[model samples]
Target: MASLVKKTKKPALQPLSFHSHPTMPPPPQTTLSTVLHLVLFLLLSSTTTAISTSQDTSDLEQDCTNKWIHIRDLPPQFNLDLLKNCSEYPLFDNFCSYLSNHGLGQKTYNDSHSWYRTDPFMLELIFHRRMLEYPCLTSDPNLANAIYLPYYAGLDSLKYLFGPAVNSSFLHGLDLFHYLAHQDSESIWHKNFGHDHFLVMARPAWDFCQPLSNDPPIFGTSLLELPEFYNVTMLTFEARAFPWQEIAIPYPTSFHPSNLALFEAWINRLRRTRRSTLMLFAAGGGISANPNVRRSIRLECDNSTNVSLNGSITMKYAKLCEFVDCSNGICEHDPIRFMKPMLQASFCLQPPGDTPTRRSTFDGILAGCIPVFFEELSAKKQYKWHLPEEKYEEFSVFIPKEEVVFKGLKILDVLMSIPRAEVRRMREKVLEMIPRVMYRKHGSSLGLRSKKDAFDIAIDGTLQRIKSRLEDSA
Candidate 1:
């Protein structure tokens, strides 16, 4: 089957407190008799009006504060059937394995606290499970502030991506929209024409967008172009600059902590780990549509050391760099292998792969290795809701791709030039960003110490965006 499996594009690379005040007493009954009675009635009427207004305001505040998410009861075909029939498809030959543990993949090892072999393609499942555990989920659609479409769009696209029929690529998505359009007039999609509804697309947005004539014809579907989905928000791993409907989210990493304590412990481990190597690059170079960047990085790795054809850097000739050569495509499926190298390195090289983004970027952050970006869209242009745009330099370094790939600039020189104190500061900022870039276990509870993780940030951002969109239209 030509190993239809994609060579893992290894990267290179607040609580509200309510206070109530007691109502003031009405003026004492003055002894004007009839005048007094009339004045008393007026005062009481005004007081009642004030009380009613206050109650309405309180109700409004409560509603505004609670972010209610309603999951649609989509037909099993849109979600469950995809899983049930996963084993039948050659494209999904190993897909069923990733469905374990609520789509967080298998555990890295027995008794491992916060690690998983998460597949980047399994995001919709993780998100669906997390949405199920959402604190403010509502059973009634009318009561929901945001609607969640529980369709496994990512999984559903596999057949199209791998099938021989290019023209049939969009049929399933078309059927999905048709199904949605046929729903009752009062259904969620009909309400605002799905403006407030959102779906998680584990793949990049381009997979669902219309492909250009010169582009690879078998790459994607026309789902993104369908009018039925125009207003629907898409939470994807990568998003385009236009179509503000798509929001880029952090790619799922190997770390899925069970609670806040474990999350904190992981950060602490990253802080205390001793990094001996100046930089690490763990990604595949054999199979990628976009190989120029990795080729440049691999060339640097090879020329710097007596690298074997396998691309491994033997310590005999190794100096400032370490390469976990993934040319065979192993690290893409098992990211844990990259962990040891990343933990021992001060910086993780994150060059764009098949797309502008790489799963290794999140993995690098998780390991507390400051990321070095060769492309602006790789990190700076995405994840606005999770990563602070103003704080990129605090945690990451940017060296333009042209400098290294075309100009032959040494990545080591730029990194070594950074002061140790500044490096430490950057590492600290990277650690601070750990929680925001990960998706904690769906049901994980951290009590009073709980911080907002990726899932929380995504839902909040979606709701806020939907609210603004609704208001603008209103």
Candidate 2:
């Protein structure tokens, strides 16, 4: 018992206080929760940046792959949504519906109010009337006239066929008004009438302020008192004196060299004026020995103060087909010689002769070249496949006067400045439009598709402009 008590007493004083230790250091202020939060934040930021980079790469690749994005490629639902933004016009809806229902071959009747009517003469008359009273008739009278004559004649025929009792006076009145409205102040009708009355009479069918009146009014005071007439007017470009002063007259008899002269003059002019960037002309025969006009053209070009002609000149006019010389239409059928050169050119200058609208320009457009146009001798005739002004702005070019001196900019230089790839794309777009802008007379598929025509392109452009103008006005 004594030994056990002594062992317990010795254990109490065994450990002494040890304050300063060399082996251990102090702990840091950072907690485990704070360290975990910083790591998670860095991981989320990195993941988000990687995802954004991957999306950007994907978008860039898609844009590079799809070159020609057509309007049709848009989703049907998206297209419908866009239509909702359009004006609610019953005329447009009905027109689109008619187009959809007719498909292209639908029989066009004289009685049909629709644009697809086969009897274009009466429609031509209506168009001419509209032109007289509007600003739309300034540029191409042949086109205006061509559209109206056939349509009006058909309308007159339809009236006679439907009702024998219908008086010819109605037609006479319509015709007379059109003639008087277009007449000059020196003409018989304008000379006798007072100005105010004449204007009033003309007001029903023609634009008052239009500057193109061939004849100015002799009397202004008494013309405004006339009663309004309800007669339906005809649309047609009237035959008249040539508008532009004669710059140069090619030897009309010599087809080849004279044609070449015209082509060279146009090219030189376009070169002088940078407005027109590209030009092409193809003839059906070799250059004539009698290069009278050609010599003149060369002299003018050499003396040209504005443009210094530096580009290489290649004469492709000799390579075209001479269907005009062929008696049996055999040369016309030879597609290889006739169409190939035109296909190569950027524009085909069309001059009127054989068929009304079948100029070299027609052949060129058929071969995928844009038609550079001048008003024809037959002012009122319309080319069935003529591209409108706006479309022509994108696809074609026009020279108004005969003298190339007015145009002093270099078209070739401007075109050359454009990237080759862009020019190639524009050429392709023109080629694609050919089928829709050309017509084939042979019933054979030698040219563009028969269903499509030049007027279609023009009308489509006109309607679009009208709609746009209306929207802008609104």
Highest TM-score, which number? 1
lDDT by residue (381-427, candidate 1, tens digit) is 88899997899989999999898867878887788778778999999
Span of 10 residues, lowest total lDDT, candidate 2: 245-254
Native-referenced Cα lDDT, model 1: 0.72
**Candidate whose lDDT is highest:** 1
Candidate 2 structure, TM-score to reference? 0.30
Off by over 4 Å in 2: 1-338, 350-358, 373-388, 398-403, 406-419, 440-474
Please give, for residues 97-195, the per-residue lDDT of candidate 2 as tens digits: 111111111112212111121111122222222222221221222122111111222222222223331232133234434444554333422332211
lDDT on C-alpha atoms for all candidate structures: 0.72, 0.29
After superposition, candidate 1 runs with Cα above 4 Å error: 1-66, 164-166, 211-216, 286-291, 305-318
